[model samples]
Structure formats: C-alpha cells, structure tokens
Target chain A: MDREFRNNKPDMFTVELFDATSDLAESLAHSEVIMRFTNSNQVLINDQDAQRLVQEANELHQKLYAKDASRDFMRENFPRYRELQNQIASNPVLQEQSEAQEMAINFLREVNQEISQLLGIDFGSLTRRPDATC
Target chain B: MDNLTLNEPEVASKSRVMEVARRFTETLAETAQYRALEETYQAFRQDGEAQAAYTALQTKQQTLRMVTMLNAVGEEDRLALKQLEDQFYGLKSVQNYIQAQETLISMCQEIGDILSDAVGLNFGLACRVGGCCG
Candidate 1:
C-alpha cells in the first residue's frame, strides 16, 4: 500500500496469490492422507460407542479436577480415567483415526518444508497466529 | 499401518501437494508485500550504519544476558542498551525493513487462515518444527 515500495499491478498479484493459496489448500485437503484422516475422523465421530466413551471420560475428567473433589476422590478415580483412555486407545476406529491424522500432519509438514526451502524462510513460523502459544 | 513410513500412494500424493505448494510460493513471491520485504531487507543488509547499530545492540544484549536475567542491570548499562536500540530503529533502512516485514506477515497470516479453514486444521501450527511442548 505504501507508494514508495509499491509493486506494479498489486491488485492482480494479490488475486493470483490468493488463487494459488486456495489451490494449494484444495490439493492438500484432497490428498490421500488427508482424505483418509478425514474419513477416519468421521467414522470415529459417528460411532455411538465411541461418542459415549469420550463423553463419559470427559465428564469423569472434569469431576476428577473439580474444585470440590477431594484428594482421595481423585486418587480413586485416576485409575478409571486411565482405563477410559486405554479403551479409547485400543479402539480400532480411534487407532486408525490417530494414525491417519499423524500421516496427514506429516504430509502437510513436508509440503511446508518444501515451500520454506524455496522461499528461504520458515513459512509456518511466519504465518503462525500472533496469539498462538505453541 | 506404520504412519511413520509413507506408502507408494502417499508418496505420490505428497509430491502433488508439494507441487501445489510450490505454485503458491511462486505467487506469494510475486506479491507487492513480498517484493517490498525483499527490497527493504536487501537495503538494510547493505546499510553499514544500520548493520553496525544492530551488531552493537546484539553484542550488548549478549554481554548483559546474565545480569538482565538476574535483574541486576545497572542504570548505565540499561541506558546504553536503550540507546543502541533507539539508534538501530531510527535508521530509515531499518524502519523500511520492519514495515515491509510486518506487511508481508499480515498477508501471510491471512493466507494461513485460508489454508487452515479449507483443510480443517491449523496449517501453520501443524507445520511448526516442534509440537505444542516446543
């Protein structure tokens, strides 16, 4: 926007950049890894047993950490919490979802690395949200 | 099922993703903000005065790192550091470089948001070098 540093055809450049960004996003979203991740996630979310287990675990977690909960109560419920987590971990659907998500994330990181190498800058770090803690 | 190892299909998909990412980076490099950032950075790098001021500030900071961490910096040392910072920021080239970087970062943030929304994940966060703990 500053005239001193303005490039020719700024508007056109912006449009092209946005279009390219969208294309990249679409390609990533449609990639086999990402699609597999999405499908597994959907399957996990749609499973009644999985949803119930997750909800129960969340409720128990809240109770364990509640202000009024006694230390003894937390100690007693901790094992149950671990059991619920193990159940979730052992579920084939959840396992598949986790594996797929990891693959998708790795694929995205590889793409980001390619872009960063080409641009000579950490694209992910540069684009990170200002308020992001991690 | 080992997510760490990419299968043949995943490898092919990753290549496609990188191709799109390359196009996105090329478009981004042509943007006005990117051009301004590059130009201003080059100017700053070539400005001897600005470079000297930056080096001075960095050296002072390094020298005072322990004292500053311990909250034992004397008035003289603090003032000296402040003066170096002021001098560094007062340069036209430095100011231009900072402005250009901020503008480019803002544009990149918007692009990151678009990617995150389309892919149902935080693109920048996911691509970060380390996970949340880092």
Candidate 2:
C-alpha cells in the first residue's frame, strides 16, 4: 500500500491519536531547547578561538585572491563578500592596531551578550537537552 | 510514530545523523556562501561608491590582480560565513532531527490512543462479524 494512504487515510481514531502524539513531541522538544539555551546564558569565545577564526578568515581572503578566475566560483559571490570584507577592514572596532585583537574579542563578547538577552534562553539547558544547541 | 531517542545516553543512530546532514546541506550551500558572495560581488561591481572604494585596492594590482582580490575577498567572506554557519548548521541539525523524531513519536502515541478507542467501540464487533459473517 502507498505510504500516504496508510498515513493520510487512517481512520478517525488513528488520526486523532497521531495528532495528539505529534503535538506533544513538538511541544516537549521546543520547551526543552528553549529552557536549555536560556540557562546556558552566553557562550564565551575565548581569545584562542577568536584568533583561530580571524586567522582562518585572513587565510581564506588571501587564498581567494590567488585563485584563477575560472578555477574558483568567486565571480558568483564577490559583491556582498566585498561589503563584509570592507566592514571588517574598515570598522573602527576591527581597525585599532594596539587593541585590535582585544577590541574584536570585546566586540564579539558584547554581541554575544546582546544575543543571549535577545534569545532569553540559557546555554546550560541547551546542552542538557538531547540534541539541542545553538 | 517516531521513538524518543534524543534523551538516550548513547550516540544517535546513523540514520538520525544522516537526516540532520541532509537538512543542513542545502542551507549550508545556499545561505552560507554562494548566495552571499554573489550579492556582495554585485554591490562591488555595480556601484560607483563601491568601485571608488575598491579602486584604491584595485590600483595596486593588474587586471588579474584586481579580479583576484575581489574574488579573494569574496571567497574569504564566504568561507568565514561557511565555517560559522557550518558550526550552527551542525548544532541545529541535531536539534532538528531530535525534534522531528519527537514529533513522530507524539503522532504515534496519538494513533495508539485512537486505535484503543476504536477497539473499545468496534474491534469486538468486527471480530464477531468477520467482514461478512464468518
């Protein structure tokens, strides 16, 4: 028998049962994740992680410059990439020489903190849930 | 109906993992990199302000160099977003998979309830009649 037939054509009882079960699962999962993310507060990206990320970004920047036109698909996406790159390159938050790295870290910290509040969820709860993480 | 396996202490089964992977692959490919790059490139290529700004960097290089730099920056942004999104994609995929299964489980439970109700009402009658009176 067709799968849809088995599912969609179920008698009224089966339909009601499926509806109740699916609703419970959705609610439970959503609640679990929401609580977890709320509890975990904000995830901290240490200097090391920040450094690795920035280094990777720079490396990617250079490598793309080196690629031949036909070899890479950069042509497809150069415009918005340029804007983001310009933002990184020009932002006072990112441009400070003596405090640039620290500034970046602080900026990210601020952003993450704001995000935490915006999300109104805890990180601890996120981890406790079976597979929920943000 | 789906089983509740997210809370299981062990590793998720391969099928669950695969389901998550498939869900993210499309999001990862489109939103994270290719689409953004294309948009950024258009901004850089079409706007005078963008051109003037980029020309500073462009002047230092030959035509190929300029192309390469734009492409380079584009690639850099794409990769950065990709890495960031990949991490997010991974986390969300697991969460989503678990959530989806939870939904299925709930559905199954509802189905079970409905079956029980029907049996209470008619299963005995059906057995007695046997389609056309066995």
Best by lDDT: 1
lDDT of 2 by residue, B8-85 (tens): 323333344333323322232233222334444454456564445344434433434655666664666556545544
Per-candidate DockQ values are: 0.40, 0.02
lDDT of 2 by residue, A17-93 (tens): 33432332222222322223222222212334434445666765665676564444566546545755665565443
DockQ, structure candidate 1: 0.40
Query: Comparing to the true complex, what docking class would candidate 2 get?
Result: incorrect
TM-score value, chain A, candidate 1: 0.79
Q: Candidate 1's residue-wise lDDT over A27-129, tens digit each?
A: 7777888888878989988998987878889999999989999999999999999999999889888789778877877877888899999999989877788
Error of 2 at B56 (Å): 1.8
Q: What is the interface RMSD of each candidate, in Å?
A: 5.9, 20.3
10 residues in a row with least lDDT, candidate 2 chain B: B118-127
Per-residue error (Å), model 2, residue B31: 5.8
Residue lDDT tens for model 1, B22-122: 98899888888888999999999999999999999999999999999999999999999999999999999999999998888887887777777656678
In TM-score terms, candidate 1 sits at 0.84
TM-score of each predicted structure versus truth: 0.84, 0.17
